[model samples]
Target chain A: MIPFRFSYHKPSSLSEAFEILSEDGAVPMLGGTDLVVKMRAKRVTPKVVVDLKFIDELHNVSFSEDEGLVIGAAVTMNELIEDFAVVKERFPVFYQAIKKVGAYQTRNRATVAGNIANSSPAADSVPPLLTYNAKVKVVSADGERLVELKDFFTGPGRNVLKPGEIIHSIIVPYESPSIGMYYKISRIKAVDLSTIGVALTIIDPDGKRDIRVALASVAPTPVRAFKAEDYIRDKELSASSVERFAELVQESTSPITDARGSKEYRWEMAKVLPKRILRELGLFEGVA
Target chain B: MTITLNVNGKNVQVDVQPNETLLDVLRNKLYITGPKEGCGNGECGACTILYNGKVVNSCLVLALEADGAEILTIEGLTKDGRLHPIQEAFIEENAFQCGFCTPGFVISTKALLDRNPNPSNEDIIEALAGNLCRCTGYQTILKAVKRAAEKLGVEK
Candidate 1:
């Protein structure tokens, strides 16, 4: 667990952090849960670690009618799980994915921005956030811009974030007129990547309407199961639809086998999970 | 660099090197030997501590980043020479074999029970997942958690 020597800078304000990020070879650290591990692995040895703990704007979770939910970049996974609004309304799948992130201890320190910024292909939060159509706000020396969450990740452990640009917050639209949930099947319940993760949000309009299903760990990035979703729209939910959608979801993802689980296992579970989630959400009656 | 951490209810300010972790600052400088270093990459929970009342991997956290934050170690579990309910439960349940992991477990359990007094079996397992015990005394550890819950009388 050896990392190269580096300069430490604790910036209390957003402008100070922007100045640091504008410098060459600088990395903005929120919680250091991901950054330190990568540093020890010698994967990313930046010359300076700009700690953003003092930045008040990057450390809050607030609600707004105009913008939806504004989640600070430094908000930990534990905070998301314990947030009353998140647990009750906006999204329950986010909590389900968060619970499997690690142990309770690590979650307390692992920030949501770090989880997304680390850009792991199997990050539990991304898929569900993608399902919700979340937006990321990136701040730099020049200014800030919002990017769609689905377009945030470019590849495994990578994103399109420009040099000297730091993610300040994520904006999730509170369009939760549906029952949304996430399910992941891992080797074990804790500290492991998902073999396949499924997120479903069914918006029932007077028992006759539209639904959306998004899934992850099935492709290079979290993908929306548009084909399967189109199959269930405006149709009465039932066991037959669940089976059909399950079959359709298997065709949606491109899962690979690593140490976590087999590609076949993931493909198989990818089919099973969506239908199970729909059932649990009461969209598909008598299918649990 | 000088860093001030409110450790164990005491405001102790100390200076450390650029490449020092919270674990290094605690054990080496402040002489707060409660947080032991196991796997310094945040996998093992040997260096667990309560930062702002939430359990975190102290080894991964830089000392400079923890300035002005309230930290609680196993030593802080007792007040006026009275053991915390979780600590008493451990003693009553005989929850240790070699005891190297006791302090970390005690602090971790305190964080869990404080937030959720009547955590379910799954909750307990989830809370302790980061901690590892070579003695395999998880049964007694679970018993201690149950005992603490009973002593508190807050079931969920």
Candidate 2:
């Protein structure tokens, strides 16, 4: 049980929620998947917990050809899974990555906004968002702004979010004729955190090939492997070229030795996983 | 905070602290102890319950969150003094030794069946992955789920 006493505020609108969040020691809560746990552990002792579920604007999920996909902060993992058709058709790699967020029950309560807001280095969803060049719509009583997902993180469990600023929604731009993949090494097959997560997206619209690669749990925050991506972009992903690309990707990581895995192991897997995924996708052919 | 909850088909009002969890309110104030607290955190699903017909760990849910919510605990599984089919199947299959995790398993099975009446073996495994049992080897639980599914009169 939580030992601290905290006031609860269930705001019915975005403005009201913003007002509540602007107060000192007030934290915005979406699904309570992360905040509640932190509260119970005394890691986050807020004087007031602002519940955002009552705000209708925060529960919306909309997609269009021009506007792309807009997923509100309150969209739960289960809601996304139920809308799998659109997600699979639009962002297949994101659909695959979100499916690995948590177990079924936890997903029922975990929200996409919370996962991104938590800013864990091993977050399963961040890498895919990076691959998609997603943007976070941050709002406050003052105003609103959109931050690129790549520049959102500042450190482990921290972001550039100012006090009273809440993530309103995530905006993923639509890409046609694209293919992507996400791979992660975890302790258990399911219901476990990622030791090293990798996501790759290749967009070939109008015959202009573009590749984006991102990794998680290998740095202070989730990062894109820009060097490897640039090295392999528009080039035939032959075995040797892909090997060199993987080495560059490995060089980009700065993983630390922890109880989950050794720094050497994470760095090695950072190289091996992308290559394995590339080979599986038939982008690279090699001898067995 | 004082909140009214629709629990087990009954509207009950209880006073709870803002920091209290749904599990705490269910066991302490409501006097419904079917939901066990094996892990206060959500890692273990022993505190699983149906919130708005979807399975969620009660320990992770705040008491304030359930103010106007409809909750179904293990105590609500029976009807007309007869055990639910899943409960009966558990008995016939001897699905539990400690029984601490049985409530969560039963609740999750109900949810799975409600969504997919004829779930494959892999489907059952995936649906029940969050609930952990130290005894009965889980094979018996699988058999019990199969039996329950059959008794629910859905084609395999």
Candidate 3:
């Protein structure tokens, strides 16, 4: 049980949630898989806990060719996997990453928005979302705005969200003929944070091998390997060039030694995993 | 806060604090001890229960959020006084050692069987990944799940 006293409010509408969140010490809770644990540990003590799952607008998951994919803030990982086949067919990397978030019971309550909102560097969903170039739809009592997923995180456990502002949904632009995967090294097979995560997507539309690489657990936040992407743009992914690309990807990281892994080990894997993963994804050509 | 919950097919009203977890209410207030508290956080699945027909950790769920929702714990698995088929299979297979994590494993297995009915070994592994057995008696537990599946009329 939590060691503090807090009032709970379940708002039926966004306006109500905004009104409650505008007050001092009022916090919006999506799934509470992370927040409730923090509260129990006394890391976060709020006077009012506003539950946002009751809002009808936050339960939407709609996709279209024009609008791409729009997943609401309250959509759980299980709902995304079971109810929507499009996610697996179109965004396999995102689907696989979501499956690796915690375990089955936690996934039943965990939301993608909550995962992003937590702003953890080891969050499984961020690397895949970053590779997909997802956008965060932020809503406030005054209005709403869209922020790029790459620029969303400010630091560890920090984001651009202001008071009274909540994420409405995540928007993923539709890309065709693209296949990608998220490979993570965790302490165990499941239920542990990723020691290092790499998401690689090769968009080969009209033979343009536009490879996008994003990584987690190597920095303060999940980041895209822009230098590597620039180096490998439209070039044939040969063994030597892929090795160089892997080195550039490793150059982009500024990791620290923690309990999960050493900084040197992360730097090494940051270089090694990309090539192996590239080969595993069948993007590498002519021997590793 | 006063909330009404349909627990084990019975509608009951209880007063709970907003900060209190559903696991605390089930084990402390209502005295339903089926869901154990191995870890206060969700790392261990000792408090697994069916919330609105989906398996979730009760410790992570607020008691207030569970208001008016249907809940099923391990106690609900028994009919009259007879043990559930899953429970019988567990005993027959000696699926547990110390038995602290039995309730959660049973609930997770039931959730899996209810949905899949004939689950593959991969399916069972995925479903029970949240639950951890300190006794390390997973082989027999797996056998029990398969045995329960057999008893439910699905061949292996």
Compare the candidates by DockQ and give the number of the best one: 3
User: Chain B vs. true chain B: TM-score for each candidate?
Assistant: 0.94, 0.97, 0.97
Residue pairs in steric clash, candidate 3? none
Second chain of candidate 3: TM-score? 0.97
Q: Chain A TM-score for model 3, please?
A: 0.97
- Cα deviation in Å at residue A243, candidate 2? 0.1
Q: Summarize candidate 2's per-residue lDDT along A1-288 as a digit string, tens digits.
A: 788998998999988887888788998888887888889889999999998888888888998878888999988988986864678777877888887876788899998899999999998988988988899999988899999999999999999999989999999998765677899889976777899999987776347768778998999999899999889877777778888889898888999988889999998899998888877777677631
Order of all candidates by lDDT, from best down to worst? 3, 2, 1
Tens digits of per-residue lDDT, candidate 3, A1-288, equal: 899999999999998898999888999999999999999999999999999999998999998877988999999999988999989888888998998988899999999999999999999999988888899999998999999999999999999999889999999988775777788998987789989999988776357768888999999999899999999897877888899999999998999999999999999999988888788877775443
Determine which window of 10 residues in candidate 2 chain A has minimal summed lDDT: A279-288
Candidate 3 chain A minimal-lDDT segment of 10 residues: A279-288
Predict model 3's lDDT versus the native: 0.91
Q: Estimate every model's Cα lDDT from 0 to 1.
A: 0.80, 0.88, 0.91
Report the lDDT tens digits of candidate 2 across residue range B1-156: 789999999998899888899999999888999999987778778999999989999998889978989999989989989999999999999999989999999999999999988899999988888898999879999999999999987533
- TM-score of chain A, predicted model 1, versus the true chain A, to 2 decimals: 0.91
Q: Give the TM-score of candidate 3.
A: 0.98
